[model samples]
Target: MRLMALFAAFSLSVSAQSVTRAGLTVTYRDPADRGQLARVFTVWQKAAQDLKAKGLTLPPATLTASRNASDFASLTGYPAHIAAITLKGNIYTQRLAALHARNLLPYTLRHEAFNLAQPPDLPRWLAEGLARVFSGEAQKDPPERTGLETLSERELDTLLARASGLGLNRVYREATRRAAQRLKQQGWQETLTLTSR
Candidate 1:
């Protein structure tokens, strides 16, 4: 059943973007409701400002709502895809917060903002890790374990078996220690560079 469901999703038809903003020189998908254009711009504009404060900005963003599975596949190449998929109600990432939600908007914008500030050609893990760092959720007492849980069950078991020798506190400390190192070495701009790739 799960396999069938995955296949169905993969074969779904995707719609392409039809409207392009000539004045701003940006691209957005053809919205079903034409009136939504203003709201779209408003949302994006506000998101841009929030991101700028976090040291990230999108020079111009291309927002699209694709129905095709291939369209989603193609988006793996873009940094904004972090927030882009979430713009659609159905495709939120398990590891990240929703982009449209009021509380999460700032973090989502900051993640994309870093993409805008850095050079492209970065590795996915590096970019995702850094984005999660500035995501604010990371700084709390218990960080979001989504990224860490991304490993397959088997992979996780392997890691856990190796880590079982250590106490829970020791393991957590090590994880944070490594995360801190990443923050110090790459910083924001460097991490963005890694993610944009």
Candidate 2:
């Protein structure tokens, strides 16, 4: 039991290197990625401002930039602990890279940060949609619309039929649309408050 406990402690220490900046903490394996870390800090700063504007409390956030796909999958296992984890190279990396090229990294970062702030019980649609909304990507482009608005009736039906096989992208789009509609009807503060329950 002592050996196992020691191993667990050592493993946790080796898994991540962290830095705190502007009230945001970032964890990663490579210390050389300081530039990327600063970028994440900027995103968090913007997100904090937006949340403050909405009169919402800013939850403590720790952004983790996973070294690779495997790391991302592992780090995200306990979603409640961290605010967000960005994979170095994965299926979505190509698309995310394009967004970065367009200087929209902050938007993506903000989206993930919003995910980190909310309770786990929050509905997928509301969580993802609010992320897009907070990130300022809700009205930007179709790719950014990861909520119900992006799906057609037929596609929605198919997704419903194969709920177990539903993709994360589809969830984001559907949630974005649903969240937008709710925001329109209920307003921001109430929408955020709903997540608590």
- The sequence of per-residue lDDT tens digits that candidate 1 reaches over residues 53-85 is 656655654444433234444654433333433
Each prediction's TM-score versus the true structure: 0.38, 0.62
Deviation in angstroms for 12 in model 1?
Answer: 18
lDDT of 2 by residue, 47-86 (tens): 8787778775566655556554455456555333223444
Off by over 4 Å in 1: 1-40, 54-57, 68-70, 74-110, 119-126, 133-197
* Cα error of candidate 1 at position 121, Å: 8.3
Please give the CA lDDT of all the candidate structures: 0.43, 0.61
Model 2 CA RMSD to the hidden true structure, in angstroms? 8.5
Name the regions of candidate 2 deviating beyond 4 angstroms. Answer: 1-16, 77-104, 119-121, 140-166, 194-197
Clashes of 2: 11
Worst 10 residues of 1 by lDDT: 88-97
Write down the TM-score for model 2. 0.62
**lDDT leader:** 2
